[model samples]
Target: MYSRKKGFISRSSRISCTTNEVTGRYSSGHSEDNSNETSNRYLSFRGFFRTAHGSSKLFLGCQNFSSLVGTKSGIEIDSDLDDGFSELEGPTVTGGMLETNVETELVEDDVDGEDVEMPHDKLELSDSESDARKAQVPEELLKAITTAPVQSLDKVMVNWVEKGNDLTRADITIIMFYLRKRHMYWRALQFSEWLELKKQLIFTERDYASHVDLIAKVHSVQKAESYIEKLPKSFRSEAVYRSLLGHCTSKGYTKKAEEIFNKMRDLGFPVTSFACGHLLTLYKQTDKKKIADVLLLMEKENIQQTEFTYRICIDAKGQSNDIAGMEQIFETMKADGMEPKMITKSNMAKHYIFAGLVEKAENVLKQMEGEMHLACRYLLPHYAALKKADDVRRIWQLCEPNARIVECMAAIEAFGNLHKIEEAEAVFDKMSKEGKNITSKHYYPLLRIYASHNMLAKGKDLVKRMSERGCAVGPLACDGLIRLYIKAGEVEKADSILQKAAERRFVKPKVVSYLAMMEEYSKRGDVHNSEKIFYQMRQAGYVRRIRQFRLLIQAYINAKAPCYGIAERMKADDVFPNRTLANMLSKSDPFRKTEASELLLYC
Candidate 1:
């Protein structure tokens, strides 16, 4: 380090100095130098400032020497910072400001995109060009997605093909297959136009069998036969043959099913367990004994015994009310290393239910809980039939939280249809406490439970809670409120509720709620109120159900009016007699000829 007084830096810079200029830069680091006199080739500040015999005055640049500000400090040289090029050759170091030259070159290097080779501070959050890439999906596939009626897909696909667009049969198959699988069965036919173009390619037995399976799954038995008859010989794979017989068995098509199974056997696919299973179901349903013998013979052939075969056996035992035989099958399954899975337990539950052994059936259901889905299939109906709401709740409690939601919701529906609203609410409360998700199915049942039990206050509280929890309170809940008000004999209140729901843009009222209001009016024997609500129902797009017609018919019969055209229409529309209709007919003495005729065909 070197220092000079701040006011005299220029004067110090003018001090004469001489030394080997190269020594200031590279000479100090010189391990090798080419010179004859080695000591003469080096110079130091001691020799340079010892004496100056030349006119050349050497000074540190003004800016470089400017910071020497002290009278108490002596000028001292301490070497630290060095750029290797500082004194390499014969070039004048004296020029413009020294630090400015270095900054100029640094800026130039930065603009020219060259590395300055200086130690630099690291940068934070530095970004580059590579972050902008996006995912790409094929344009053709995107264009195929349409919200229009599916009938349009077939035409679009045809145009694509005719226009030499690179779409394939596989693409068309995927779209239609998904459509049917998603329960868009009616819409799936629209894709048949596109499918027709690929008929020749897709008409193989395997493809036809797959289509038969699709039809069976969709519950389109009538369509299944029509399509099966139209299929070519190449399209009747083993599965197709089995599906045709399977359909027959399900619909109790014994002769047709047996015929198809026999034909399958003739075609050398006789070893099929599915065909055998259908035969067993046929015999079981009709009380034919030959099914077991035939099934046993096929089993001995060392062919794979499927779960469906055991299912048939279980069904047969249940249908015959053969409890011992069913137990025998359960033992056989265990001995054969087949654990009692949900399907096995479900069969037992079904058998027990038919036998009126509710406790035993419940034990079986609980034992198989979560081991399979559809365990609720047997239990939901059993509880509904027995009016056992607590039984339904117990079964759901034994299920996983997710499975419980699905099962309990189903139970709620079954109970609601039976008008056991209290039972449905009890199950729903359990579901809510169990921390299962609430869905739309749970909504109406919960609302009706509140209404039927005269707990509309609680019901309104539930609706508010649902909104707070971000759950959807659809129109069904509002409709339920309307019925509750009517059933509680607050007709004006019910009307107000309906108006509020409509103004707030709740979904449309369900048909049952409308019918209930109309029925309430009919119970008052008030024709005017019933007709007004009935017309409103029509304007609201509700079709008159059989029950609705019966309600109105009962009111007319109670009036005992002679047949005008209106009364004739009401009589014809009556699906079944209500209490008023029955009472009216009963009042007419048995000797009344018209009343006697009416009683015979009343329902």
Candidate 2:
């Protein structure tokens, strides 16, 4: 067993810097320490929530990054929420920032010689009657409900249902799906609330799970958990808890994720591979050492590992620079009869290239040559990282014959990384010429290239072109714009972009965008704007990490402003200062000598 005390990161380990020169940002490490004594008992993942013996309700894993959700038009929408939504008011987007609902279907199945209906069967519509009910749906209902104000959603939904239009579960699901696809999470949450209030349908575990997921998206995870408590005990199944766990993992809420995992076991749900896999994913990103604990628990319980489980293990080892350990995991996976997919091979090659094992990476790429058309996107980046411009061109030539939007995107990134700005622009120009169905996704890589090279005029021209083309504006593009203005010393212009984007409720500014502005202000000793953005970030529901506190304190020091309650603020956020931040705090708050002295040991 891993040492329980080792799960918590010491203050000494938190001094690393997160540098992004293109954005003119500096960040202190964001690791969370798990020092609570109560957490030790649950360090092992052996007690996580699992499917009961002979149960039909199996836990569904989170969707893969490349997994596509089918829509009426067959557009492949990304399932990850971090990409943010594009300009919702624009014409129907051919590409960029669309996501789909990947929830498991609520269907009945036979398990252990019994016909078992899944939880949340209330969320499903009868196939035989669905077509008839769908035909009865009012054409105006979706538009009227989704486009209405949050305060008016209830009235609109109620009025539509009372008008005698058949509202089936399928209709409700489609509404939620489209709303989410458009990145109208707030409107979706309102629709869900209206559904819950009507009492027209009895909600099951799946319905509650969907609501909790939406709540976490629109509001905060804390609110989502509170909503869970108010749910009937029967509705709090393994699926519901797993939904909470998945959101927490995505948001990097390590402490809260552990609490939910422990509660799952306390509720008598046995350990399942799905729960363990989530813990592995969480640890892999935040604290790789803790991954061993999860692996141990899986071994002790004899849980059959899935391909995703092996992938996470390989990633954790690769991230830690344990090449031999990573290879061992890959070998073990094959021994267990798990076949690696194309993406898996890409990730392996990526790590190998990062490790400077050029021959090994090339060998892996050779293995992938059979699927070169599909693998070109991955191959281009790997070769680009190796600085092999010829190989990048070679892969492009292969892809050039029938290059899809995704291949073009990879080529842009690869050429940009190689500082082939002209070549990158050439790709963009070709996309425009070939009528490649461009979206904001295609613009971001070139925008990033411009920002990195301080090509302010080019970046501005590109933004104008995007506007002319009606490509959706999203946080990623806005982030690129912010970096461009900051690079040109047009800080106020960058600030204006952030403010205007934030005003659009659907277009939330990225954490990096906020940090870029805050960092610039801090360097100039502009405490007022620094403090303003700091509070804005908090109000935006961003968990304040040590980096924000460090920047805020630096602003106070530069301005020669006396800061009060800095220590209290840090404590409230559970963000303690590292040595560098400790010194900054001492300089900014001279009166708090006692607190400064307490933090100075690291200094």
Instruction: Please provide, for model 2 over 1-603, each residue's C-alpha lDDT reduced to its tens digit, 9 standing for 90 to 100.
Output: 122332212222211111121012112222222223223223212111111221211111111121111111001112222212223223343333222111111111111111211112222233343354344344588768654654787888888878888877767766765565455666777887877888755676767877887788667788998998988888888878877777676555667878788778768777787778777776665554445456546655678778888787666556555565567667767776889878778878977987899999999998887898669888998989999999999889888988887788789989999999989999888877786456654677888889888999888778767756755565667778888889988888788877766665433566667877899999998999999999987776555366678889989888888889999999887665656778887777767657567899679
Give the TM-scores of the predictions, in the order they appear. 0.43, 0.69
lDDT for predicted candidate 2 compared with the true structure = 0.64
Model 2: residues with Cα > 4 Å off, grouped in runs? 1-166, 199-202, 429-442, 503-507, 521-532, 544-546, 549-572, 575-603
TM-score of 1: 0.43
Q: Give the Å error, residue 31, model 2.
A: 22
Error of 2 at 537 (Å): 3.1
Clashing pairs in 2: none
- Model 2 misses residue 184 by how many Å? 2.9
Predicted structure with the largest TM-score when compared to the true one: 2
Error of 1 at 234 (Å): 3.9
lDDT of each: 0.47, 0.64
